[model samples]
Target: MAENGTGVVEFVLMGFQLQAAQGMGLFIVFLACYVITLGGNLGMILLIQSNPRLHTPMYFFLGHLSFLDSCYSSVIVPQLLETLGTHKMIITFERCATQFFFFTLYASTECFLLAVMAYDRYMAVCNPLLYTMAMTPRMCLGLVATAYAGAMVNSVVRTGCTFSFSFCKSNHIDFFFCDLPSLLKLACSETSLREQVIFLLAFLVITTSTSVILVSYLFIIRAILKIRTASGKAKTFSTCASHMTAVALFFGTLVFIYLKGNMGKSLWEDKIVSVFYTVVIPMLNPIIYSMRNKEVKEALKKVLRRMKVS
Candidate 1:
């Protein structure tokens, strides 16, 4: 076994090296993505906060989702940008653990939050008479709280389990950040138990949330079909189209990366997949939600007008 602590203080991340010859170009691209991710999510939050008209259950959930996206992107992107710029991919053990913790937390929370949003839609469309009472402000607060709590618990479990294992090998993490599976691969001890635990957790979260969202949407579709007016159906569907797109993209990338065996994939391949969930999805979320929703546009205009007046 390698010396316990003497090998290296920091693990070097080998971020997208396939296009290594064009380091400057990749840096520029990621920089632009980071900027847009931050600005878009922040703008959404600001718009929702400033507009009284947006003070409803749907926008309430959206505001929190935007905030989570901002936090999620911020957790990974700045470090990634630095790696792209300097090609110095060193990350300290403590920093790596912290990054992995928050990344897992926010990612898991997003899964639950998306499910909650689907439930909100289901209630609004399928149980119109009881929608307000069903999705009360107190209920909304509780749902958001549960999402965060679940995320924190999952983060603690994953991070605690990963770090508890002894790391006597080389400290080089092949990817940009301390991803759970990559870090697991480095542990000196056997990871059968850890793998089992993680797989179970993944199954529980993904299957449970996906099942709920799917069932809710089934009811939503039935209710939409019952609407006699074509325009009414269109309007109702439009409200959820953005969310459905987001759910598809987010879960698709997640399953591809985590559910599949990471058998022969290169670190470069892993980083590319990581980009979809870590960076691209968050950047696209605000645009998808805002562009598709008339209320958000009106909120934006109102906020811009207020800013101009000030």
Candidate 2:
């Protein structure tokens, strides 16, 4: 702790600790990735908003997801780039806390939002007759609002509990960014109970979200199986391919990295997986959706043609 148990005024992020040449190389690579991630997500959102055909509840949720991805990636990547560039990775206490708050907020928001998308897919497939009536604009708006509200509350609770511990010993954070696990590891106080609470909440949150998605997909599967024609089943399942891929990548990485409750694992493999979810996923999400869905490709074509004409 810095000042009578108040904690350190700032943290020094030991991000990768590579040689100067390697650090610059990695910086260029990540900087390029960050730019592409921003472009892809922003483009997705704009295309969704501009195209009349994409004004449905599905696209509405997708647009919001793109927005969140853009923001979420931005939260961590800029500082990471800075760390790689200058080799002095320092973050003040207040700034670190703020970054952590928004990080949790967006991460949790994406979790719930993905679940909501799964539910939408379920309604479209299993309850096609009532799909339009079921997902009215008001209802869609309310569901999106609930996702944001729930995530915001969860972020607040977690961030509050995390910063409550005092960091007396070292100010060195092992990771590139201000993540919860690294922050917890730096604290001088006993954090067993806090860790338990965090683990329980993470368990509940991820389990509940993934369970809803799984159940929705189970119904979707049953409904698809009831179809007599193979083509019909193929078409129905295609609608979910993009979302299913995204959910898989997301949940898979988290399960690998943190399911064992070993966030303090400073292995290079762990860092790579963390980068997969935090940096790489944002870039991949737009590509996955755009590639799997014909509608998005058509929308991009229209947008490009209009741009050329203008």
Each candidate: RMSD to true structure? Answer: 2.1, 1.4
Leading candidate by lDDT = 2
Measured by TM-score, the strongest candidate is 2
Q: What lDDT does model 1 reach?
A: 0.84
Supply the TM-score for candidate 1.
Answer: 0.94
- The 10-residue segment of model 1 with minimum total lDDT is 1-10
Residues 71-163 of candidate 1 have per-residue lDDT tens digits of 988899989888888777788877888888898888899999999999999998888899988999999999999999988988888887777
User: Where does candidate 2 stray beyond 4 Å?
Assistant: 1-5, 264-266
Q: What stretches of model 1 exceed 4 Å from their correct place?
A: 1-9, 18-21, 263-267, 306-310
Whole-model lDDT per candidate: 0.84, 0.89
